[model samples]
Target: MSKAIMDLTELLERVENDRELIRDLLLIFKEEFPRHLQALRDAVDSMDGEKVAAEAHTMKGMLSTLSATSAASAAARLEQLGRNRKVCEFQEAYAAFENISKKLLLQLDTCMAEVGG
Candidate 1:
């Protein structure tokens, strides 16, 4: 089988093994992810370094909470690019982050399903 996107074991531990809490968090993430993604896209398109940095930072925190290491790493890269004011690299970095985030969404859906949320 393919590798899991997020570390559910770690995440569950962090949440005190409350599957309901995990499901709730996943639902919230699913609801909010698109808005966050759009904000990041807008920031990137407008070449707003500060906004990009802020958005990426928020996304990194969210992904980290879910134990999505790869997606969090991608967000961190984008955050750094924004911090360094690397507008030229924004598109590439955002694309990579977006790709990982899409997979993360899928994983979250699967997790929610498994938890009966």
Candidate 2:
């Protein structure tokens, strides 16, 4: 796993503290993550740093709530890059977040399955 998804280990600890919280997080992931991705895709397609930063900030907040450290950090970096007009860095950060997001989703699937969700 990349550094972006590494915080999932800590998130797992949270899940143990409250199954309902995990369920709530899963719902947010199902709902917000897709929208976050679309915003990112549109930002990338348009090469709009403003939109990129907005989307990255949104993703960062959501990922932080889920305790997805690596993804959140990646998103934060993208947001920062966008804010700084560093398009190349933003693009790289977006790619990193994309990878981490996929891995997180897959891991979530397994977690949900284990709980018969």
Candidate 3:
């Protein structure tokens, strides 16, 4: 099997092994991720470099919190591209980030089902 996107091991440790808290945080991430993704996409589509940087930074923070390293790195790259005013240069990074994020969302859904159900 492939590695999971949202690895809770580090997060679980940081939270003192509170599984419930982990579940709650993951739920929050699940609820808000789509909106963030949409905003990022819109920013990219509009070639708004500032918006792209801001959205990508926000995404980086969120993914980092969940220990989603690959996605977070992708987000960081997107942010850097935006910072360089290279919005048009972020197609590859954005695509990779989007793909990873979708996979993470699916993993989160499965986790939430397992924990919240």
Candidate 4:
């Protein structure tokens, strides 16, 4: 099997191995991520570059917290496109971000299942 969606070792270390805290944060991520993703999709579809940047920035922060580096970078790309008001470039960036997000969510779900989260 592949590795866990996120390697929480560092996170746990930072929290001194507080398992409950880790669980809580993961649960919050699970709850919030889908909504954030949907908002990003909506912003992209509407060609609202500013909104896309805002949503992507938010996603970047959340993904960074989980150490999902590639996914976070995908979000960052979208954020940059939005910041630059690159409407023509939005489609490809949005596609990449969306694809990465789907994979990331699958990884998250697998990890959550393993942990009985």
Candidate 5:
């Protein structure tokens, strides 16, 4: 089973009762994740399937912290393709990432709402 995705209050509690961790985490999410996302986007846009796969693999590895199951799986698939030089799977990988990211973000939004921010 997957780890339960955390609500914002739980996240805040874990940071030694300081909600500042939420802000810090949000900053990291915004600053670092978009770069990784853009890397995937650019790699995909350029049709450099290997780069796409590599970027996806990197993303998948890091995204595990969020316990976003589909995203992790998508990244794994992309990594396999990139490592194997099998570029044709890019579409499936992209689709997986897209679906997973949406679901995970929605869950996060709900968590945030529950916690008052």
Candidate 6:
């Protein structure tokens, strides 16, 4: 199989190898991700740079915590674009973030399954 998206080994280490906590964290992320995504879409659509920055920042932290480096990087890009008020770049940046976010979600699901969440 291809390399996993999130570094589960690293994540487990960070969580002190608590599979149950990992499962709970993944569940919370799954629950919150959609809402966060919607907020990001709204921020992008409205060209609200500050809002986008806030949303992207939140996502970046979450993704980083999960060891999803690629998605976290995508989110960091969005956060930077928003902070720089690059409205013209929002569409492309958001698209990239969205694509990576989808993959991250799938990876998270796989992780959840592996952890028996």
Q: Which candidate wins on TM-score? A: 1
List CA RMSD, all candidates.
1.1, 2.7, 1.5, 2.1, 4.3, 1.2
Q: Rank the candidates by lDDT, best first.
A: 1, 6, 3, 4, 2, 5
Model 3 residue 50 lDDT score: 89
Against the reference, the lDDT scores of all candidates come to 0.91, 0.76, 0.86, 0.82, 0.65, 0.91
Better-scoring candidate (TM-score), 3 or 6: 6
How well is each residue in 1-117 modelled by candidate 5, as lDDT tens digits? Answer: 533343444455555655545655555664677788778877866768679777887777656644455567777887777777676767667777766666665566555455455
lDDT of 2 at 47: 78
Clashing pairs in 1: none
* Model 5 spans > 4 angstroms off: 1-23, 114-117
Tens digit of per-residue lDDT, candidate 4, span 1-117: 654446666666777877676677778988998899889889888999999999999999988887778788989999999998898888899899888777777776665554456
Residue-level lDDT for 43 in candidate 4: 89
Error of 3 at 101 (Å): 0.5
Error of model 1, residue 101, in angstroms: 0.7
Better of 2 and 3 by TM-score: 3
Full-model lDDT, candidate 6:
0.91
User: Tens digits of per-residue lDDT for model 3 on 1-117?
Assistant: 868987766767777877787788787888898899999999898888888899999999989988889899999999999889886687777898999998898788777665553
Q: Clashing pairs in model 3?
A: none
Which residue ranges in model 1 land beyond 4 Å of their true spot?
none
**TM-score attained by model 6:** 0.94
Q: Which residue window of length 10 is worst by lDDT in model 2?
A: 1-10
Candidate 3 regions exceeding 4 Å error are: 113-117
Which residue pairs in candidate 4 collide? none
User: TM-scores, in order shown?
Assistant: 0.94, 0.81, 0.91, 0.84, 0.66, 0.94
Error of 4 at 7 (Å): 2.8
